[model samples]
Target: MDAVARVRWAQVGAGGHVARRTSAWWERLVAAREGRAPQRLVHAVLEVVVDGSVRSVDMAPTWGRSAGARRVVVTGPVGSRLLGWWPLFRYELRVVDAPAPPDHVLHVSDDLPLPADVLDDLALVPALTWGRDEAGAGDMWTSNSVVSWLLERHGVTSVGPPAGHRAPGWDAGRCVARR
Candidate 1:
């Protein structure tokens, strides 16, 4: 196998209009209670380069069945007859080629020299309950949790939200990954 070239991460605005607005409002409320100014809300995604090919890793809602080969797992209350019936309640871990990150990207981390083993572990992230505070990290699991979980699994701990910004559920991922 060719040596792994590079790994980097991008912090982007939440994908949908509703998600963006809701995240902003929630963060604002939390910040206000803590006596700090609200930080810009963001989500994390990874871009990995190997043998000159770029692959993006992220978790997203299973809106449809078109994820094709990129979808790794569909997780969340799949056994519950209520939530299992709706795609909105399920999420997928995806590794897509030549990914197009959402608009309004907030920050991009410097490239990290990661080992190839980390890529092999991408599909192995635990299928934790999404949108639920399963880790007791004080926040619900979301895409940010997935990214942080993968990073933590490989001992990459310093990557985080940029200055004056926040990525909710980040700590939750790390918390769960550590167990």
Candidate 2:
């Protein structure tokens, strides 16, 4: 990574649980730099729109700091809420089409309500679970189910600790390449 290249991460759902994890990592990244190393910042670039206007921008707090970002990690829904935060992050979102070093990681649950066409448009694949166990249905992905499906299909690696792990400030785990 370039010294000046800011680690860019984007969260689609800022209000969700996964968004909190992403934000925690961003905050930690910023602290690690301490004005010396390159900055690692997340953004709420995409918006989730249902009717017509904006709905939510899950990763808005990330845009307040660090300016250089190269990748987007979507976790929640993208609708009208997210549209409002687009100006903060001017970088275009790149959807990973295959197994690769994911710029971001998303949550994949079974309960979220997303249109079939939208899911098809993104070409998402189920993270694949052996049915709910002790963790119950919620034990699945930590972020939005829609984002999780897209990530699993494209083979993008997730950063930071798993949904519930160590302190909020830290990468879940090194980028995991599927194939």
Candidate 3:
């Protein structure tokens, strides 16, 4: 474990046009069916300052096997090569050095004082099945789940989305990690 000076979590809007639109529409539909107003949807990513440099931890679509260290690719049902969707369902668990947060960020959590051991554990996140309700948390596994899972694994439980926004599949990740 190196000297981790700062750690924070960000809630950002979906980066892709289709993803943003689809997520918003789905949230609206679910909220209406449940008789509640829709909350804005966001995704979670972590930023850790170790040895005076920033490292980003996030899960994102592979987009044709982009290369980087500390990246692990996980398969999704619809995006699997067996389903003829080679890169579509492929996701990478990225621990990128000196990375910037994605565009359209909604909220950034205050810097959290996490142990160096916790930051070290980021590279060891489980390769859970993406887009599946395997955790029985009543939601599919997603990028949000990955963030939550990593946090819960290291006993960092106080972080979550800010006001007026929701991180879908977050509970699923925590639930799975608890097991």
Best by lDDT: 1
Each candidate's lDDT (Cα)? 0.70, 0.30, 0.68
Backbone clashes per model, in order?
Answer: 0, 23, 1
Worst window of 10 by summed lDDT in candidate 2: 168-177
Q: How do the residues 7-68 of candidate 2 rate in per-residue lDDT, one tens digit apiece? A: 22343234476856765665566557665442333231222334432222122223444444
Off by over 4 Å in 3: 1-16, 68-70, 73-85, 117-120
| All models, RMSD in angstroms | 3.1, 15.6, 3.2
Pick the TM-score winner: 1
Model 1, 25-84: lDDT tens per residue? 878888998899988877777777777777777677678657465746445543233685
By TM-score, how accurate is candidate 1?
0.81
Model 3 misses residue 69 by how many Å? 6.0
Q: Give the local distance difference test score of model 1.
A: 0.70
Model 1 off-target regions past 4 Å?
Answer: 1-16, 33-35, 77-82
Q: Write the per-residue lDDT of candidate 3 for residues 39-146, one digit (tens) a residue.
A: 887777777776577777767776754575554534344323354256665676767777766776666766666566555565555555676676578877787887
Q: TM-scores of all models?
A: 0.81, 0.21, 0.79
